[model samples]
Target: MNDSSSGRTRDPSPAAEDPDLVRARAGDDAAFGRLVAPLRRELHVHCYRMLGSVHDADDALQEALLRAWRGVGRHTGRGSLRSWLYAIATRTCLDAATTRRRRALPVDLGPASDRVPPDGVARTEVAWLGPYPDIAITTGPLGPHARYEQREAVELAFVAALQHLPGNQRAALLLFDVLGYSVAEIAAMMDTSTTSVNSALARARRMVAERVPPATQQQTLREIGDDRLRRLVTAFAAAFERRDVDALVALLAEDVTWSMPPLAQWYAGLDAVADFATEVPLGSCPSWRSLPTSANGQPAVAFYLGEDRTGTHHGWSVTVLTLRGDRVAGITSFVGEDHFVRFALPVSVGGETAVGRCS
Candidate 1:
């Protein structure tokens, strides 16, 4: 079997020779841990893409792993253990999705606001899309025939588009197009027929094609190259620190968009985005500082806001930048202190000591 985690083939007779699988089958919990430790990160990424929220993915992956442990005795060893686990995980995510509403971005709910509302409130009741820390994603595609690189699969646009799909369609698309599974394999994993899987895939393709951009951020970054991309994000962070709205606006594309999830308002076009940048982040906010970070495989920054008396900067948001050619085309600032924890960022930045960049 191929170890998708390492991109290498495993010993063909591992089901018979591997002691971890043998012990796991005999109900040794430690043995089961050893057997699954290698696949955890990638599986979590899969869950995140399927569910659209890291918290939901954490719950679903835990539930699926428990299910796998409980049912390990049923494994026939006819297929790779990776495939079996994925089948269980996908089913678990589907069940969870059925009971909950699909995650969404503010733009998905309505038309973009031309001007900021006087009292724009965070919609706590809505299950908004959450950002994924790039630390969780590995660099390459999971399989030989996979269409999207692993990073591209978890890109914000792709994951957001997945939320627009039905559970079955989403599963079929991810398993087939992203993970490089065969139609027959997906059908069996999904407990459906090849005809059904094909139908789901076709519908999913059309919907995602309509929503996702023509260029993935991974492709754009590669075109920009590392040196230039580094300089770009550095300049972005500096602009916020200096509170220079003109410097920030110079980094955006003409069709740029700025949206903060949980907040019901989003601004589109260069004019509106610049206005929001001027009014909210630059003009109204107290003190601003930022550290470069990556999210959903895109260049991002961890913004901090300092209160008047505290003299300390608190974590504000993880703003992921979507680039078009040389300029930012989209800015999705996921505002919340909880997000800082997920990215292993400090909740507070003290005076004079500079924060380091997160890769």
Candidate 2:
């Protein structure tokens, strides 16, 4: 088989090697690479959601790929190749999760004073989940698979909230809920009983509900195209950069929610969100810059600000904006420098002051 885009012939056909499927079954690395390479990006996204951290997902993906390559020869071809890879990837995530506690954002913790304490409280260790590369999620021609249809599950809030569950529970939930795996299949992959799988899934659901707010079940936001989201985000950037709280308020939904993670307190409603921005230190900062990015399949901004006499660009936060209709419904500000590189975001905005008005 060969990938036409890359122009690389990977592995010869099993039938070509052996009509009985004996030779190709006897350890062909080329065949194994061919089988898994096409699915790497999706598998990485899966691992990211399961682990709730991009760094962890990357590690788990590498491990899963290695395991799949080594074990591909043992395949009897009774199951779909995608399903088998998922089994391996899920197991790898479970193992990793078992070794580490679930990560939380600072917003998950209660808010402290905006002023830096002299003692300097250590930042919360909540698993600061990173955004997946847009190319990974949007790339390639998608088939009619259920996995392709459930792209929203990969969003930042969804993935970050997932970290609250225990590893096994996370695995069970994703397998059953997102991947639509059968109970018996999940049990086999988990090496546990069906009852246990059910229990894990239940716990996972409760945890997800508690951490990630219930999104509107209506399909209004799901159909939002990239262009529309970009326009809304640009408007937001322009309003904030120009210190036009009125315009900002106009763009927000009546019940918009504004949260800065690692700090659990959130402001709700357009009035409250507007007040928080205009009254808070974030609003008072003299110069602000925002670059467009996507997290969890939603529009986001990587924020930066001018600092002191040094002209250095101080890292501020990532705002993951959730849209409802043409308005902003939620804003999650993930603060700090550690998350920037992981998201593959630039340190500073290139030019212009406003959102759509970028030069």
TM-score of 1: 0.93
After superposition on all C-alphas, the RMSD of every candidate to the true structure, in Å, is: 4.4, 7.4
User: Per-residue lDDT tens digits of candidate 1, residues 1-359?
Assistant: 11234452232324654778888889999998998788788789889999999999999999999999999878767788888888999999999999988899999899999787766788999999999999878642354445676788889999999999999999998887778778888889999999999999999989999998888898899899999999999989988888899999999999899999889899999899888878877877767778899999999999988753246788889999999988999999998889999999988786643333221
Model 2 misplacement above 4 A? 1-30, 111-124, 138-148, 206-218, 222-228, 261-272, 279-283, 307-316, 336-345, 351-359
TM-score of each: 0.93, 0.75
- Each model's lDDT comes to 0.86, 0.67
Give candidate 1's whole-model lDDT: 0.86
Runs of candidate 1 with Cα error greater than 4 angstroms are: 1-13, 139-141, 308-310, 351-359
- TM-score top scorer: 1
Ten contiguous residues minimizing lDDT sum, candidate 1: 1-10
